[model samples]
Target: MRIDGRARALIAADDRGLLYGDGLFETLRVRAGVCPLWDRHVARLRVGCRRLRLPPPAAGALERDRDALIAGAADAVLRITWTRGSGMRGYAPPLAATPRCVLALAPAPAIPVHWYARGIRVRFCDVRLARQPRLAGIKHLNRLEQVLARAEWRDAAIAEGLMLDTGGHVIGATAANVFAVIDDMLVTPRLDQAGVAGVGRAVLLDAFPKTRVRALRRTDLERASEVLLVSAVRGALPVRRLDARRLPVGPWAR
Candidate 1:
């Protein structure tokens, strides 16, 4: 692990990221010593930095760190966490805050090999996401909502849980974005109010530019013929069942 462009393991205890979640992160899948979606990830990170009012990393700082860590490496998951460095005991940020970027590379998660071919089951989470348009669509450090939603179930048969915002709008899954095929039309939820706009969802939208982006409800998901849960780690997985509703793995998911 490297922090602030150096090979280090620890950060200050008073760091704003640790105290108040004042940071953003990007999780990229690395293959053959390269990130497949580096450009998209950087683009999203730039947007996140702009929204969070934090200084972007130094020129080529991330690239240099990534190169040093993934040298001659095989498949892995590289997470880059950028945080507002240590500050006094308060919510207001320091004027000359020095941001810290920590890069950690780990073995790629072992996904069920058959999940792609055979869909996975999911349930609706009881925890409702707080609607915060200012923080929507960015990969921020605060993830308690997702954490609580994930803890809702522990059944091995259930792969994930769909999360809804306070207004009953389908935000996304605990970790991924949701896509539905309603009336033979591809549709996804709008992230203006809540949820992260994942890169996998962006890939699908680029592939199918006609896919509608709108406010979706549980009823819309129920009416859909097929649904897909997409994420950066797991590209796209078909949803075999939503709670008790049986869904088919159609050509879209295949």
Candidate 2:
């Protein structure tokens, strides 16, 4: 995809993101020409930059650039990527780095009206995310694990796939964070070791203060009263089935 004001055929050859997947990205839902969670996304991007030891760009400048990119789209998915820019021939980060930021806008995926009403089916993926506390809860560019997991299923019958960590703990879905209702309590996986803390998850937790974040096992998920997959673009989707286990629709599932 083209970035900035240029039509380069490919991403910069020397980009650290290309070399080592050293970058952070945010996916935001654009509704009616406005990004509702723009501030929160920007906050997370800034925090990710700090954690990665990268220079933060001017907020106004970045917003202006992003707005220009999405000005034509009525409803779209806005993705902003921040990389460590070009680097020398080594793993060591450069002392004087000019961070590269890319803003792109694309059409949002069409959501089936019936799927939202009847809930969606999901399956457990075999790909296990490696535990890395340092990178936990951040939307980093290293997504090979998710890419692999998503490829496991080609059937249109399955809507999403839930993922677990190496420790066999339920972390999240392939492309979204998971939340479930157990014993009338809202529970979601704690992203202390794996998984990206999704922006939609943050909004739900903030909206419902009683929601709890904790480590969940496979058994806990199976016994949950309701399961929901959440993402910035998809909002909250009820889970109908996971693998061979069939989950019944409940009031909480709504």
The number of the candidate with the highest TM-score is 1
Off by over 4 Å in 2: 5-9
Candidate 1, residue 209: Cα displacement in angstroms equals 0.4
Q: What is the TM-score of each predicted model, taking all chains together?
A: 0.98, 0.96
Worst 10 residues of 2 by lDDT: 1-10
User: What are the lDDT scores of the predictions, listed in order?
Assistant: 0.94, 0.88
Pairs of residues at least 3 apart in sequence or in different chains that clash in candidate 2: none
Q: Write the per-residue lDDT of candidate 2 for residues 31-111, one digit (tens) a residue.
A: 878899999899898888888998987758777777676766788998888899999978999999888888877898999
lDDT of 1 by residue, 33-131 (tens): 999999899889889999999988877989999999998779899999999888999999999888989999999988998899989999999999999
Q: Candidate 2 — what's its lDDT?
A: 0.88
Deviation in angstroms for 246 in model 1? 0.9
